[model samples]
Target: MTAREVTKADKAEPGSPEWLKLVTASKIPSILGISRFKSQFALWHEMAGNVPSEPISESRQDDFDYGHAVELAAAEYWRYKNDGWVISRGEVQYTDDALEFGNAATIDGRASRGAWRRIVEIKTARDLEEWGDDGSGEVPADYAAQVIWQQLITGWHEPANIVLWPQYGKPKIYSIEYDAQIAASILTLVREWNASLASGIPPELDDSITTYETVRRLHPEIDGREVQLDAALAHDYLTAVTDDKEITKRLRGLKTRVLDAMGNAQTAVVVDLKIATRSPARGDAIALRSNTKADPATIEGISA
Candidate 1:
C-alpha cells in the first residue's frame, strides 16, 4: 500500500535515471517535513521502500480535497506569467551531478519573468498567517528545505512559492532565493538520514509528541510483558524521571510567579504579548490559545 507511483522508467532498470526520479521526484512535499522528528521515519521508509499504508484520516481527506485547487492556482499563475515571458510546464525529472545523493526531481512547473527564472511550488494552507512576516517571502522551514532540494535537482537557485488560502481569492507569492550553504547542510542531514537507514538504525527522537504517538500506534503496549533495556538506557530513563519531577516543580513555581504578578487582574500585559485570566467555575485560569482548529483534548467538553 505504498503511495509510490509507477512510471515508464520502472520497466527499464532499477538504478536508471527514471527510477531515481520515480523515487525522489514524485514525493509529496507536505509529508517531507525535515524539521519534524517523525520525518526520519519517512526517510527510512523511502530507503527501505517499506511505506506502511497510512489510514485515510480526517486530516488527510481534507488535504486531498484542497490539493487540486492548489494545482489549479499554480496553473493560473503560470498562465499569467506566460503572458509576459517564456516558461515551461510539464512532468520533467532533473538530476544534479554535484549533490552527494544526486536524487532526481519532478517539478510542477518552471517560470521566468524578465531575468528571474525559478521553479514554482504550489500549496494550499488552511492558515496563511503562520507563514510569517506577511511580505518578507517567508515560507515554512520544511517547505524551504523541500524547495531547496528541488533547486538542487533543477540546477536552479531560485524558487517561487505560490501558496493559496482556501478562504481567500488571491494567492500569496513568495520569491525565495536559497543559500547554498543551508542547502548543503540540509543535504548533509539527509545523507546521515540515509546512512542511518542503511545501518538499520533509527534516528534519535526529538521533541515531538507525534513521533511518540506514531510509535504507540504501530506497536501498542502489551500487558504483563517486560522488555529489558540496556543498563545505560535504563539508568537514563530513571534519570529522566527524576529530572521530570524537578522540572514539574520548577514549572509550578514559574506559573505561580506569573499568576502572582497578575493577582486579581483580568488582563496582564507582558510587553508585546497579552496574558488574560479567564474564570471557569470558582477558579481563574490563564487564557490559552490552541494552534489547531479543534478544541484542546485536555479541556472539558472536548474529546480526542
Candidate 2:
C-alpha cells in the first residue's frame, strides 16, 4: 500500500499531539537503530507515550529556528541555481494507510525539472567531510534513512535529493535513489514496533543517555521505599563498581609513571601516534575549604 497526501484541515502541526500518534520520517532512523542522536528504546517510550519529550532549551530552539531559516534560504538558492526547475517550499505532509503502523512524512520542499520531480530535504552541517561530492548520494546513514523514509511515505520512485549547507562551503546536493529492499525492511520494523506499542511493551533497554533520560522520566519521584532487587543484578553492579575503582587507581598510577618518564617533555608519541599529551596548567588550583569547620590555627613554635 502507498501513502496519500494529507489535507490541510486534517494535517497536524509538528510536535503536536496528532503528529505524535504517527511515526514520522525524522524518527525512522531511531527506530532502525541508525540514529546517532536517539536510541530505539527512547523512541519506543515516546511512541508509547510512557514519557514526554524533554523540553527544548532556548538555545536549542534558536538553533532550530536558525536551521529552518537556512533551509528556506537553501531552497531559494537551489531554485536560483537551476533556472528551469520549479521549486515549492514549506512542509508537505503525507500519511500511509497501506501500512498497519501509520507512517507519515513532512518533507522540506519539492523540486521539479522538466518531468522529474523529487523530494528535497535540507540539512545543515559543521563537518564537510561527512558529505560526498555533489550528487554522489553518499550521506550519513541516519540522514539517508530519513530521506528514504520520506520517499517511502511519498511513494516517489524518483531519486530524492538532500541539500546540505556546510559551515564554510557552498551547499551540496546528494541524490538518493529509492531502495525497495530497504523500504520493505523499514516497513517490517515499523509494523513490529507498532505491535509492541499496541501490546504496551517497549524496546529492550540500552545504555544510551537518551534511554537513561527516558527511564528517569518514567519514574520522576521516589516513594522513599526500598524494594529487594535481584541478587545477580546487585552482585553485577557491585562488581562493576569495584572494578571501576581499581581501574581508576591503576590509571592514576600509570599516568604518574608516564609523566615521570616524560620528565620535561609534554607529549608522548609512538610512531606518529600521539599516545598522551599533557596540557599546560592554566592557573593556580583553588584549595577546597570545608564549610563545616576551618583548619585549626597553626601554632607558631609552641605546638607539642
Candidate 3:
C-alpha cells in the first residue's frame, strides 16, 4: 500500500492528537445547502486548527469504525468491475504535496462503462426508508453534499451515491450531476470560513440547540460570578421566562383536566383529532432469583 501524504488540513500541532485537527470532510456538510450554521463558523474554525475540538465519544467512534468497515467491504466487492477506461478503487487526492489546490475525499469506487465514468460513494444506512424510490432516487441532503464535494475534488463528471440498505433487496444507486454555480458558491463559503478562522473573530451564533450547548460548555457558570443585565436586556429575559412559566402552567392544567375527564376511555377526541391518554402496554421484566450467588466485593461496595 502506498503511503498517503498529509495535507495542511490533516496536519496538527507537533504534539497535538489527531482529533483536535480540523478535517476537510467535516466542513463539507456546512456547504450542503446553506453557507451558514448555528454557531456561525466558530465550531468549524475550532475543528480546522483555530482552537481545540472535543474528542468523539468512544461509542460513536465505534459506530463510525463499523460503518467504515462495512463501506470498505462494499467498495471492495465492486472494485473488480472496472473493465475498460474505468479505474476501480482509484486513490483520489484532494491536494498535492504542496497543498495549493483541491480538498480531501476518499471515493469508495470509480467505474466507467464505455463513454460513461462515475465516482461511486458507498453508504451503510440503518434503514432503506431514508431513500426515496418514487423513481426520483433521492438521497438525503448531507449525503448529496458529500458526493458533490467528491465530484468537485476528484473531477468525476458524475458521482454515484450507492446506499446499502440491508432490509432492501438491492443497493440504491443515485447518479448525480454537478452544478457549476453551486460548486463556485461552496468554494466561496469555504474561503469565508477560512478568513473567519484567520481573523480570530467568529461570526454570530445561530438559534440551534447545539449552539446553545456549545456555548454552555465553553463558559460554564463560575460560583458567585453574577453580572446584572441592563434594563432592556433584563426586561426581555424576564418577559420570556414569565411567559414560558404561564404557558407551561396552562398546558399542565389542560392535560390534567383531560386526564381527569378521560376516566376509563383510552382515547380522547378533541374536535376532529384523537389524543391518546392511555400508556403503552409494556412487557414484564425478568425477576432476579434468590438462589443466584452474590459476590463479597459487591457487598463491600453496597455497605459504602
Candidate 4:
C-alpha cells in the first residue's frame, strides 16, 4: 500500500495487527532511500512519541537488528531497576496516524504495575569511532530538533535519553532536553515544507541554504573567511521572503552577479557589496565581502 494509504489507519489502538502493519508500512518509502528520508523518519518518530526505530528493509533488516539490540539494552537497564522488570517487546501505541495531531508515547511495557514509563530512543552505530568524542554522539541537528518536537507532542516534562549501541563496543547514552520554542518553529517549517511538497514544488534555497563549500566555491573571495550565521539569522532571512518568485529571482540574480564578477577577474579582489534586508533594525547593511584577486586591469574594467 502507498504511504498515504498506510497512514490512514488509527495508530494508537493496542492489540490491533492492522495498526502495526500500517505503522510499519508507512515508513517503507522513507527507508528505501538515503536522501532526506532520515530527517523525515526522525520527524515521524518525534510525532509518534516513541523511540525512533530504523525503517524496515527486507534486504538488510537493519531496523530489526537494531530493535533487537535495543531489546537487549532495555533488558540490561531493567537489571538496575529496584522494582521487577515489566518489559514487553512491542506493546504500545505512540500515536494515531488517522489523526494528524497526537502524543508521543510508548506502545510497549511498564516498569511496574502503576508506572508506565517509556523506553528511551535507541541508535546503533558500527563502532565507538562513529560517535563524537564529546560523549553526546553525533546526533544530527535536525534529529535533535525532532526529539524536541516529540517532547512537545507527548507533553513529557523530563529530559529524554538517547541510547547509542555500537556494534563492537558498550552502549553510550546521551541525554536531550526539549525546547518548546524550537519545536513550535520546526513544526511551522514542517507544515510549510509538506504543503510545498504536496503541491509538487520543491523548496527554494536561499543565502542560508548554501553550504560552506558551496558558498566558498561560488564566491572565491569568501574562501577561508570565517563568518558565523546562527539560527536566528537564517530564520529571519527565510521568514522575510514570503513570495517564492521574488526569492528565486533574487537568488538567481545574486548568483549570476557573483559568478560574473569572479570569472572576469584574474587576481583576488575584495568587493564591498550592499546586502538588502527588510529588517527595521539593520535596514540596508553594507558588508565588505571579499573575493579572489583577479588582474587589476580586469577588475577595473568590471568595476567601470
| Candidate topping lDDT | 2
lDDT (Cα, tens digit) per residue for candidate 2, span 115-167: 77679889987544355423344688999898888888877778887888876
In model 2, state the lDDT of residue 4: 82
Report the error of model 4 at residue 230, Å.
35
Indicate the TM-score of model 4.
0.43
- The order by descending TM-score is 2, 3, 1, 4
Greater TM-score among 3 and 4 belongs to: 3
TM, every model: 0.59, 0.75, 0.60, 0.43
lDDT of 1 by residue, 125-146 (tens): 5434456423334676666667
Deviating ranges (above 4 Å) for candidate 4: 1-9, 12-57, 78-91, 96-119, 133-138, 204-304
Local error of candidate 1 at residue 62 (angstroms): 3.9
- Candidate 2: deviation at residue 202, Å? 1.3
Over the full model, what C-alpha lDDT does candidate 4 score relative to the true structure? 0.44
Each candidate: what lDDT? 0.55, 0.77, 0.55, 0.44
Candidate 4 displacement at residue 21 in angstroms = 15
Best of the candidates, TM-score: 2
